[model samples]
Target: MKYLSLLLFLVSITIAGQNDAIAKDYYNKGEFEKALHEYKKLYAQSSSNINYINQIVSTYQQLEQYDEAETFLLNILERINYPAFFVELGYNFQLKNEPEKANTYYNKALASIDVNPNHVFGIARLFQSHSLLEEAITAYNKAKALKPDFNFNLQMAQIYGEQGDLEKMFTSYIEFAVSSPIALNNVKRAINDFITEDSTNDNNIILRKILLKKLQEDPNLLWNKLLSWLFIQQKDFKKAFAQEKAIFNRESESLSGLEELALIALNDGQEDIALEIFTYLINTAQDIDTQLSAHHNILLLRTKLSNKEDFPNIKAQYNKIFEQYGKLPQTLDLQISYAHFLAFYDDKPEAAAQVLDHALDLPLNALQEAKVKLELGDILLLQEKFNKALIYFSQIQRNLKNSTISQEARFKVAKASYYKGDFKWAESQLNILKSSTSQLIANDALELKLLISDNKYEDSTQTALKLYAKADLLAFQNKKEESIIWLDKILKGHKTEPIVAQALYKQGQLFEEQSHYEGAITNYELIITNYRDGILVDDALFHLANIYIKQFNEPEKAKALLEQIIFNHADSIYFVDARKQYRALRGDAIK
Candidate 1:
C-alpha cells in the first residue's frame, strides 16, 4: 500500500509540471485564452503557487480583461493581505486610462514601503512595467531612505540613461563604482555607450566635466581611473598617463596596470606618451625583470621612431642594453629584437647572424633555440644566402615536427625556394603546408601555391613571374624603392600578362608607403578600370577608399568607393570591413 501511494504521488507531481509548462508555452505564443484556462486549473490545485497566480493575472491583462485581473488581485489581497497586489491593481487601472484610480493605488503601494522596505523592488518593477518611471524612481528612493545599507545606484544609473539624463547617469555609475570596486569594468562598459572616439563629443565633454568635478570635490581614486579610461577613449594618451600616475600614487598599486596602459598607447601609435610611460617604469621598477622589459620596449619604441640617420644611435642603445643584461634566457626577446634591428634596419646581416649565433650558445630550451634559428634563417635569406637559410629552416622542421614554429619554418623554406626560382621545389613544400595548423601560414602557402600554378604555364620561360617574385622579396626586405623599380620592369614588359594586375597593386602599396597619394591612386584606378574582373579589384577599391578617407580627407569620394565594394563585391573578403567603415564615415553610431 505504501509503495503504491508513493508511485501515485510521483505521477501527480509530473502531471502538474507538464500542465504548468503548457500554460507558459501558450502564454509565450500569445494564446492567452488557453493559457488562462490552464493556469486557472493549476491555481485551483495549488492555491499557494504565486507563479501560477501571477501568470493567471498576467494572462487576463494580456487578453484585455482588466476587470478580471483586478478582481483576481483584490480577492488575493483580501485573503493574504499582500502589499504587491496594490501595484498590480494600480497597473490595471492605468492600463484602463483611469488615472485617478491608478494614482490612488500607486500612493497606497508607496505608503506600504514605509512599513516594509523590501516591498520596494516588486512595486518599483510594477510601476516600471506600466511606464511610470517617475513613480518607480520615487519608490526606489523611499526604499533607500528607509534602509540605509541598500545599494540602488546601478538601477538608478540605468534608469537615468534610459531617460537621456546623461549627467545623472554618469554620477550614478560613479557612485556605484565607489561602493563596489570590482564592478569598475562593468561601469566602464556602460559609459562607453555614450562616448565616442572624438573627445569633443558632447557626451564625452559632459563625462569629463563630471569626473573633474568629482575629483575636485573629494579627490577619490575612482575618479582617476575613470578619467584615465575617458582619455584613452579619446586617444589622449598623455592625459591618460597623467591620470594613471595619480591612481598609482593614491592607491600605492603596482606598475602592471600602468604597463598595460603604456602598451595600449604604443599600439595606438602614440610614441611620445608610450616612451614617457616606459621610461618611468624603467626608473621606478624595483625588480630586475620589469626593468629589463621596460628597457627592451624602450629600444623597440626608438627603433620605430628611428630614421636612417638615427640608426647609429639606436644601434648604440641596443648594444648598451645587451651589455647590461647579457644573453640570458630571460633576455631572449631583446636579443631577437636586436638581431632583427641589426639585419633589417642597419643593413648588417653578417653582424646580425653573429649576434643570434652567440645567443644560441646559451642554455636554452627547444622553443628558444627555434626562435633564434628562425631569425638567423630570415637574415640569411635576406642576404640571398639560400643554401644556408634552407639548412636552418629544415633543422627547425625536423626538431619541432608538429609545432606552429615548424609550420612557419616550412613556409619559409617554400618562400626561399620561390625566391631562388626553384618553382618545383617550392610547390612541393607549399602543397604540404596548405593545411598547416596556423591559419596565417596556411593562407600564405595557398596564395603562393596559386601564384606559382597560375603563371607557370602562362610563359614557358616564366621570366615575368620570376621577376615579380624577386620584387616581392625585395618589398619583404624593406627595400621598397627597389621593389617599385622591379615592379615597373614587369609592368613595362608584361603588359597583358595575368601578373600585371598584381604588379600594379604592389606598386600602389609602395607609392602609398612613400606618401605619393596621386601615384597610388593612379595604379589603383588602373586595376579597377582594366582589371575589374580580376582578383585585385576589391583590394584596389578598399585601399583607394582608405587613402581618400584618411590621407586626402575626402569622405564623400571614399563613401562612393566603399559603396561599390558593398554592392558590387558582396562576397569579397573586404565586405564586412567596407560596410563598417561606410557606416562610420556616415556618422552612424558604432554599436
Candidate 2:
C-alpha cells in the first residue's frame, strides 16, 4: 500500500506541473478560456494560493462574469490584505450597473496605505467608461498623485477634453509638454481639438491666451505652429502672415501654413491680406497646382473689390488672361464672364455682342454655343431692343431642341410681345407656353394669358348690359382689371341698369388698380351718394378704406374711411380688415 501511495503522489505531481505549463502557455497566447479551465482545476486543489485566486478572478473578468468575478475578489480581500482587490470589486460592480456599490468599493481601495497604482487607474477607467466625467476626473487625479506618469496624464487630459472642459485640458497638455518635450504633437492636437469644439468667441480668445502663454514660455517649432493657427482663427492676418513668413524663412518652404493663412483671410473678407499671401504662394510654391490655385484666388479677390467704374481694369485683366491662354479650351469660361461684365457693368452692349459673336466664330461645341446664345439674348433684352432680343432667343430655341432653354426662349418671346403691346400675338404665344415643362415659365405664361383674354372680353362692351354674363365670368376668374373695366363701360353706357351699383363699385376697384386713389374714392362716394340702398355700398366703403390705407398711404384718411365702414357697413365682407386697420391706425397696437 505504501509503495502504491508513493507512485500515485509522483503521478499527481507530474500532472500538476503539466497543467501549470499548459495554463501559462494559454495565458501567453491570450486564449483566456483555455487558460481559465486549466487554472480552475489548479485553483480547486490549491484554494489558498493567491496567484490561483487572481487567475480565477482574471478569467471571470475576461468572460464578463461580473458576479463571479466580484465574489472571487471579495473572497481574496477577506483572507489577504490585497488593496487592488477592492478596485477589482469596484470594476465588477460597475460592469453590473451598480454604481453605488462601485463607489463604495472604490473609496475603500483609495483608503488603503498599500494601494496599487493600477487599482487607482482601474477606478478612473471605470468612472470614465460609465460617463461619470466629474467622478472620473477625481479618480484620474488620484491615480496621477499615486503615479505621475505620461499614460495616466494623457488619459486624464483626453477625458477632460471629451467633457469640453478646455481649461483642464489645456493645463494637462501643458504639463505633459513640459515633462515630455517629445509629446509636442500631442499638445498641438489637444489645443486644436479644444478650439474646434469651442463655439463662443470668448472661449476661443481664452484658448488663444493660453497658447500664447505657452509659446512665450516654450520657443519651440510646435509652439510657433500653434501660434500661427491661433492668429488665423482670430482673423489677425498680419500676425499670421508674419509667423508663417518667419517659419518659411527659417525653413526652406511651408506651403501648408501659407495656404491656411490665405484661406483665413479670404473667409474674413480681408481681400488685401489674401492677395498678399496668394502672391507669396505664386512666387515661392514649387507645385503647379498650388501656384494655379494662388493665381485664381488673387484674380477672384481683385474682381470682387473692383467696381463698375473699374471696368477698364477688369477688361484689361481678362484681356491678359485671353492673350496668355487663348488657345486653351478652359479660356472659354473667362470669355463668357468678361462678355457678361461688359454688357452689364461697362454699359458696352456693342462690345459684349462683338465678344460673343467672335466666340460663335470659334470651333465651339453645342453646349458652349447654347450658353453664349443665352447670354447674347440677355444682353439684347437689357438693351430694350425687343426685335433683336427675339432673334437671339429664337436661335437658342431652334438649336436647343426640346430643352429647358427652349421653354425659356418661348416664354421670353411672349414677354417681348407683351412689352410691345401686341396683345393678340402675345396671348397666342403665352397660350402655347402655358403648357411648358418648367413650372415657373408655365405659371407666368398662364397669368399673362388670363390677363389678355380678360382684357379683350372687357373691352368688347358695345351695349350697356350686353356683357353682364362675361363680366361675371371675369370676376369668377379673379380678373379684377377686366371685370372693373366692363363694369365701368356699363355705368357709362347704361346708367339705369339694375347692376349700376355693382358696376360703380367695380369701377372703384379699377381706379385702385391704376393707383388713382382720388378716382377710386370718388367712385366709392358715388356708390354711397347715388346708391345708398345698393348691396355694393358696404363693399365700396370698405374698399375705399383699403385704397386710403394701402395706395395713398394717408393714415388719417384711411382711419376715417375704416371708421365709416365699421359704423355704416358693419355687416360688410371687408369688416375684418377694416376693423383691424382702424384699430392699428388708432394706435391700439392691433396684431
Candidate 3:
C-alpha cells in the first residue's frame, strides 16, 4: 500500500511540472491561446495556489476574454479575500469599457483596504480617466492623507489647474512646496499664472502678498526664480535686474532672469527697459541659442521704436543675421519675418520680393515654394504693382490647389484687381470667394462685396462718379479689370464735388477690402478728418473702430469710438451696433 501511494505521488508531481513547463513555453513563444489553455488546466488542478490563478487570469485578460478572467478572479477573491486581485479585475473591466463593472470592482477593492494608498491611487486614476475630476481629487486627497508624497501632490495640483480652479491649484502647489522645497519652481509658475489671470482681483493681490511674506520669513527661499516672478508682477524691473545680477554674481548661474525681465518690460511697453535687458543678455549669454534670441528681440524692439531714418541700420542688422544663420533650416522663420519687415515697414517691396525669391529658389519642398509665392504676391500687391503680384498669386493657385495657400491666393487675386481699379472683376471673384472653406477668406470676400454693392447706388452726381459707380457695379458682378478702367477715368476727371467724397471713400474701402487694416485705418481717418460732413462719416468711424478692435487689439480705443457713436450720433443707424460693441468691450455678457 505504501509503494502504491509513492507511485501515485510521483505521477502527480510529474503532471504538475509538465503543465508548468507547457504554460511557460507557450507564453514565451507568444502563443497566448496555447498558453491560456495550459495555464487554465494547471489553475484547475491547483485551485488554492494564487500564483497559478493569477497566471490564468492574466492570460485570459490578454486574450480579451474578460468574462473568463472576471470569473476566475471573483472565485479566487471569494476564497482568498485579496484586494489587489479586485483592483486588477477593475482595470480589466475598464479596458473593456464597462465602467459600471469597473467601478463595482474598484469599490469592492476599496472596501477590503483599511488604508491602502496604492488602491486609493488606482481608484483616483480611474475617476480621472472618466473626467470625474472632483471624485478624483477626493480620492487623491485620501491617498495624500494616508501618505503625502511628491507624485500624488503633483497630480492633484495638475488636476486642479485643468479644472481652472486656480486657488485650489495654487494651494496644492504650495503644499507640494512645503513638503519638497525643490518644487519651488512649480509654485512660482502657478503663482505667476494665478496673478496674471486674476490681475485685477483683490484675491490675487492678497495671494501675492502672502507669497512675498512667506519668502521674507525665510530669506533663503528667495531664489532667482521667485525673485524674478515677484519683481515682474510688481513691475519693478530695476529690482528684477538686480536679482538676476545677484544670481549670476553669487552662483555663476546663467542670467535666465534677464530674459523674463526683458519680456515683462516689453509687455508693459517699457521699450527702453526691455532694450537694456536684451543688451545685457546679448553680452552675457554664453549659449548660442540664448545670444541669437536676445539679438532677435533687441532688433524687434529697435524696429518698434524706429522712425524712417532708422530703417537703414535695421535693414543692415537683418542682413547680418541672414548672412550668419541663413544656411540653417531653423532660421527660416526669422528669414520670413525679416522679409515681411522690409516689405511693410521699410517700404522696400522689391527687397521683400528679392528675399522671398531667394527663399523659393532654395532646396525647398512644394509646400515651402507655395508659401513663399503667396507672400511674394502680398508684397507686390502692397506696392501697388498688381500685374507683377498676379504672377506669384497664379503660381500658388496652380501648384497648391487644395491647400491653404491656394485659398489665400484666390482671395489675393480679387484684392489685386481691386487695387488696380477693376471693381467689377474684384466683385465677381469675391462673390465666388465668399463661400471659401477658410473663414477669414470668406469674411474678407463678403465684406468687400458689401462695400462695392452698397456704395454704387449712392454715386450719382459727377459724370466721372457715374462711370466709377458703373465700374464698381460691374466689379460686383465679377468684371474686375473693366472696373479698374472706370475708376481710373474717375480719378483722371478729378471732379471736386460730393462725388469726390464717394471716390475717396471707395479708395479707403478698397484698402480695407485687402485686409490692410493700417492702410484702411489711415484712409478712414482721412475721411473722418477731411470729409466729416460727408455721408460716409458714420460708416468710416464704425470701420475705424472695427480696425482698432480686430486688427490692432486696442479695445480701449475701440470702446471710445463705440461710445462716441452712441453719444454724438444717437440718431445714426450705427448706434445699436456701437452700444453692443461698447458692452462687449466692457466685458458684459451678451444675451
Off by over 4 Å in 1: 1-63, 75-85, 251-253, 397-404, 417-468, 486-506, 522-546, 555-591
Q: What is the C-alpha lDDT profile of model 1 across 1-591, one tens digit per residue?
A: 999999999999999999999999999999999999999999999986778877888899899999989989999988875677798888889889998998899999999999999998888877776668788889999999999898889988888887788889889999999999999999999988777766767788889999999999998888988999999978898898899988877776488878988999998778888889999998887887888888889998888677899998988887787788777898998989999999988898888888898999999999999999999999998999999999999999999998999999999999999999999999999999999989999988998998899888889999998999999899878798999999999999999899999899989999998889999999999999999998889999999999998899999999999999999999998998798678657764332
Worst lDDT run of 10 residues, candidate 1, spans: 582-591
lDDT of 3 by residue, 204-290 (tens): 555555556665676543444455566666567876787777667666666666787788889877788888888888788878677
1-591 per-residue lDDT for model 2 (tens digits): 999999999999899889989998998898989999999999888877767776777777778887778777877778877665666677788778898998888777666523666656545654576576776677666766777662555777788778877676767776677667788776776665445322244446666677678778866555566667667655578878988887887776558888878987897678888889999998898876676667667666676566667767877877886675572435556666777777766778899899888888888887778778877877776676779989988888888876877888887777666655566787888888878888888877885675556444444442443354346445533355777777767777767655566666666776775567787888898987898887677777777776776667788877877787788888876886687567656654111
Model 1, CA-based lDDT? 0.89
lDDT of each: 0.89, 0.71, 0.71
Candidate 2 accuracy as lDDT: 0.71
lDDT of 3: 0.71
Models ranked on lDDT: 1, 2, 3
The top-ranked prediction according to TM-score is 1
So what's the TM-score on candidate 3? 0.46
Give residue 58's error in model 3 in angstroms.
46
Candidate 3 local Cα displacement, residue 36, angstroms: 53
In model 3, which runs have C-alpha deviations exceeding 4 angstroms? 1-173, 176-204, 214-270, 273-297, 326-348, 423-450, 453-591
